[model samples]
Target: MTTTQDISQLYPNALWNWFAQICAIPHPSKYEAKLSAHIQQWAAEKGLPVVVDHVGNLIIRKAATAGMENCKTVVIQAHLDMVPQKNADKQHDFVLDAIEPRIDGEWVKANGTTLGADNGIGMASALAILGADDIPHGPLEVLLTVDEEAGMTGAFGLQAGMLNAEILINTDSEQEGEIYMGCAGGVDAEIRLPLSTENTPSGLRQYTLYISGLKGGHSGVNIHLGRGNANKLLARFLAGHANELGIRISDISGGTLRNAIPREAQCRFLIAPEQVTLLNQRIAQYEQILNSELRQTEPALKVRVEESDTQADKVLSLSAQTRWINLLNACPNGVIRMSDDIPGVTETSLNLGVISIENGHGRALCLIRSLIDTGREQVESMLTSLSDIAGAEISLSGCYPGWKPDTSSPVMKIVKDTYESIYHKEPDIMVIHAGLECGLFKKHYPELDMVSIGPTIRFPHGPDEMVNIKTVGQYWELLLAVLARIPQKTA
Candidate 1:
């Protein structure tokens, strides 16, 4: 596969060149040390001061350009990690391979995997600014936080006294014309249920039920799109047919990241030799039903039953199977409620994004998001009740508060006015439904003013992810203009 595909030849060579370098490194969440260290060395070569925080975040600072020293210190921020998601047929390893970006029509995408353009462009923009001595800007600081995809470890571990900036421009938002002033808070729920297995009956054949080809996206941003969740689909099939087909599941697993909607799932089970024929017929019938039900959202959904070559002498106990099926059905996996306050905005949502059942244990990882504390709490309350009745243990962690909108904020005003002047039109100023680290930054640096901007990226955190070519240029120009117009610092 072509690694770079001439993206470095795109407009703004300085920015695209940096992005090219980033694509060459593997920087998935929890595995960003290489990329972080690479950037530190790169910064040192540029003669810029670099600071490494205890949480593995990189802070690179540069002095003001000539006359712009009087302007307020501006911080450009972007997360260094990208979500690792790929199609079942794809062989690329996110932690060992370079993202091969290819230009298709007016957008740039990858070869059967996520393009990582959601925040790669943002990081490139910051690096570009830092590399240029001609671009007029105030005292500049580039904050590259690690592990923003799977978790917000860097942001959560950020110390208050580390930053001396008055304004923060987050390059993590997806829309080019949209200015994100606030974002939802989120928490991850990990549900665990102990399992027991029984000896498999003789003359039983092994079969693996597979579900794939569904478009799984960012759990938060695409939850409202009504995409099919592969885990939920697997549960639906097993719950409906386990007893009828006399299936004894040996192993069941689906999804990958807790923050990403699962695109594929599979269940390995044993069935009687005579029932195999009936099971095939039923699978065909069920596949038809699922396709019809999800025709609009999941046209390419595939459900198949394959004979497994691996031998199994054990299967989940009948009681364990029942408990697992019931919990899967009872669990909340999509949008719970839309915001009554903000029209068309999601208020609270849950995604049962990942699950694994094997080795005498079953685990389900879910992510819950909400704009307000109470809304998130409401969903948590439901999960609490579900766990109580399901005889399982549920734990919530990585909880972070939401970034509340500040319409009267001076930084908000500056961004709005600057966009209007540059584009000659009003930009969409709104709060994002997804989680952004701006919320954590607000909690840690209450005195800092923040806003988010980025190029138009589609299907982020999925194999179908892509970035629009034209908007990259537009976003870059707007970012430069915003920096030039940073308000003068005052007491």
Candidate 2:
């Protein structure tokens, strides 16, 4: 894998240079100390005022250029961390290793991990604007937040009085021309079930059920895509075998993050020896059935079950395992409602993103999203009650409010006009299903006017993630136009 430094000679633009430098540091959420230090060092070198918050968020401000002092102060915001995920075969460590980003024609991507371009581009744009003393601009502050992927910890932990910008330009959306006016609030619920075990029957055999190759994505945005949830499917198989073959689970694990649909899952357990041939036949039948069921959306789905080393000790007692399997099967995943306000938009969705059996206990993690607060609460309550009924202890965290759309704001108009003037067409303005830091920022700065825009990015939060190289220039032009056209603030 070639590091960013090795490609600097080939693509040497200042914006790309900045991105490459950031890529050299491993900045996974909550593990962003090194990346934050780099930003602080850059700010000190430029003689800019930099503040380091308790959660590692860094805000660096620069004085307005000579003639732009009277212009309103604006904050360019982006998260400093990226989701740490990769191909199962990849050997990179997200905490101590740098991402090896590569350029493919007009796109930039990582070798086998997510390209941090989702927010790396935002960071690069801020750096480019701040460093360009010759570029036309106004008083500016760049807020680089940490732990955005894991929980928005940086924004959640923001101090009472840390910022002064009255206008925020969030460069975190993926669509280049579209302006994200609002976003959905989200919460993660973790369900844990106690364990009990039973001795294995003699002449029984162990089998591992494996599901992989499904196209997993951000649970909120892609839940409606009908992507296969391997955890749920695996549980269904185990439940079906509970009475027929005397299946007792040894271990079950799937999905790494709470916000991503499970692409792969594997379950190891013991089954009656006489049923080995019968189970193999059933596995083949299930692989075919799943293929047919998910063929339209998850064409690459694969399901296989094979014999594995039997654990000396059972993972879940018979009773506990039965309840756990029942809970997994009962939990819902995928789109729950379509937007009544916007035609063809998904209004609410759910994802059973993670399941694990650890230390003889089982835990399930799920994420639910909705544009309407009432609907979100409805779904969350359902999951809570369901977990309780299953006798599993439930905990919810990382809840953040949504950004209500403001279609008539002056800042919103300015961004729209800028895009029309530059692109010669109207840009789409819509609300996203995923969470953004803008909502949290609004809590602290209620009077702050905000609009989010960014270059085109695809498959964010996954290893196939990439950013459009050409759109970067177009987005930069639009941002500059918006700055130049900023109306004088009312006293």
Candidate 3:
């Protein structure tokens, strides 16, 4: 047996072992077959009732132990999929490989790829509770949904009348101290720009304008942080000089994920050799302006302009390049509005997530998120109008509803009481901007009162993802306390 630097010593005995075993599985989004099966097998081994839905969601129900029979059943929910993101140089296949997670004191992180600690830790907690007989609790049902990252396919496909639990605890929140009661609804707008090119002007030199090194993050959750969008910024520069420098584009590319803010974007094209000096001067001026704008949030923003390997024969058609710049400049990025109800919260936002030029087609993707339906519609409608103007093919997907918070729930009072009893302090209750499965789950079980909580995680949906080992214990304790306090049904 190969033991690759164990970190089981960091967590409590049972949970430590459970998390370690979970880290050994490769459960990337849309590729959760093995992980789902492993969960089913574990349930079978424990002699629990386990069922796999049509979409591979595994729901395992453990009957109430002797004394806890009368207590209400509590659903512990978490996704089984992980985001598969790695650094530009790392070469690990998420579909066929497991994360090599390591412990840095109290923080547990992966080597180079994303740790999947976001939901994996939550799943591990649920499994540990289900597997152990020592933990004190009421009747428990674990709902392990698949493909949460790419889309909430499992949550969407959940059959009616499937769950008996009237109260749910979603252990997917990233922050440790606060409880998330709501989240913004989101949708992805995909625009494919048709490409048609012409010949390059002779005597023009080829150059590559590159931008990289900005800390990209979740478009919805971190959009208000003032992080720079490389695609939009790059377009600003190109639009400023497209005609002045006789610039022509060959190709344009940017960020990877639709849910993440674009950190880097690059464009290759030809410009007059004599105008290179002028271009350099303009680039420096733009860099200063952008740096000043993003100083607080994206301090490490970088831009590089270099000479390209062109045989003096290839260059983008002037007409195509012109249209591309027009579209890029027209596309919207950043927070659209501030919430009127919740002070200091962004009510609506859009991220110009991706751009690609390939095979005579230039495509762009934008993500729009909002707590209010009208705000979401406004931004999406604007994108559709832009697509029509640019003559680009457009599509949208991954639409999800917002989880409107119920401040007067009886379950909320129970949870607050439990927390106060355990820690002697009030837990901060707020809503998050990131997408969560609770919204969809509530659609199926409207009577269900749900609240989400979890350990502190940093840099989620990115390669530097890490979960605080200490907070896991506190979160576990809180969940168990809530479960134990559920009102018993009188026979």
Candidate 4:
């Protein structure tokens, strides 16, 4: 009974070593060139044929084992990039500083930053198999894609016929006991609310009203958890009293990534000196109301008002302030629809993920996701209508199709059986709410059967991300068992 959580000494040294090596390098989304090069170099050293596509996806190949020459060629897919998120006090840079991972009680986590275990653990398992010769398997191909966090650039740009594997195993799914057969499609809506400044009103004092201590998680996976969204909460206070109290905005900033639910948000604004007491009262009142409303979901939710001496010559004009505050309050967040076909599965949702104001312009980004195209369209149309009515400009980007679930998938059956054999029970076979590259891969390789599996990871795309250590060993063992049990290619 080893109770060590240090990943280095965790069971199965090869896989953990690979993950540790990855953490030493900065491979944040849109900045995977270094990690890509490192993998390519490792492949070259091992004499395996590695190809880097125009979009920077890596396909490293290995020959079948002695007795499995007739088995189906397998493609194990994992993304190379991790979402870059950090606590406000954490001084680590995603593009420059390496992630410092440590052992918690039962999980491995980073120091006030994302642990990168979402796909890093999966990627490491693939590399472990690729670097080994004793693992029994058919022809193997590891498709390491880039920019999977910010966008599915590598998966979308993957050229057809590049991989002849009849089956693909995606190592990006979150939980260990559930095997993902499909995933949602998504589109990002970017809002640009025009800004104009008016001369500061007289007899005003500056203050920063902030919402913090919210436990934000992945927008797609945790949207239904009813956690408090800092951006929306901050807007509620301002929206309720902006006009009555004449709260002139100086600058507003919240959330970091469009794919992450905003954990904390703050606004720096000006108010009449006499209204300071009233503003404090409002925040204290609202904080209690919010905490009660979200006591079950967000236990640490906090709202505060602090006096500030920050300089500001002008604030948003009355019209701009009204529109911005209105849009924030009206924007929809959280699960909008539930799957009628799949019980307890989210069918459609929207996350008002990031909001910021700078350089005379304010921007708010919303990410829409749905299991069906019509579901996504309905939300997009609704967002467009809201933006238009609020006099805000909106544009849609990064639109990707959903991975429709196939209940009769052959490879999924194999994976399920393997999990049952290992754990003495059936694994949950279902579609995921989050976007995986499988949708894009299925578009390019319609004949290819695919399934996603991974170790248990919690709070991805944020600073609190952690991976369950025990599940990593189980996930690795199951992946190897599935490969060894892969049925022979049929003529």
Which model scores highest in TM-score? Answer: 1
Segments of candidate 2 deviating more than 4 angstroms = 1-12
Residue range 1-491, candidate 1, lDDT tens digits:
44484888898788888888888899888888888888898899999999999988999999999888889999999999999998888999888998889888888898898989978999999999999978999999999998899889989989988888989999999987889888999999988988888898788889999999899998888889999999999999888889999998889899999989999999999999999989999899989999999999999999999998876988889999899888987898899999887787898999998899745678999999999999899998999899888888999999999999988888778778888998999999878888899989987799888999999999999999999989999899988888888878786
Candidate 3, residues 302-364: lDDT per residue as tens digits? 777999775445555667677788899989899999898887778999989889887788888
Q: Lowest summed-lDDT stretch of 10 residues in model 4?
A: 1-10
Cα lDDT, model 4, residue 257? 86
**lDDT for model 1, on a 0 to 1 scale?**
0.90
TM-score list, all predictions: 0.98, 0.95, 0.93, 0.97
Better of 1 and 2 by lDDT: 1
Cα lDDT of model 3 overall?
0.83
Clashes, model 2: 2
Ranking by lDDT: 4, 1, 2, 3
lDDT per residue (tens digit) for residues 1-491 in model 2: 55576445443266778889888999888888898888788879989999888778899999887788778888999999898878878999999888999878778889988888879988888987888767666778899998888899887887667888778999988888889898888888888888877676566677888988877877766777777888988888888876677777778899988887787899888887787888888888888998898899788788888776745554457778889899999997888888888766678888898899876668888887878888788888888888889988888887888888887877889999889988899999988888888888887788888999998988787787888878887888898888887765568
- For model 3, what is the alpha-carbon lDDT of residue 458? 82
Identify the runs in model 3 with alpha carbons over 4 angstroms from their true place.
1-5, 200-205, 310-316
lDDT of each: 0.90, 0.83, 0.83, 0.91
Q: Which should have the higher TM-score, number 1 or number 3?
A: 1
* lDDT (10s digit) by residue, model 4, range 376-446: 99999998999899888899999999998988999999999999998999899878899999999878799
User: In model 4, which runs have C-alpha deviations exceeding 4 angstroms?
Assistant: 1-5
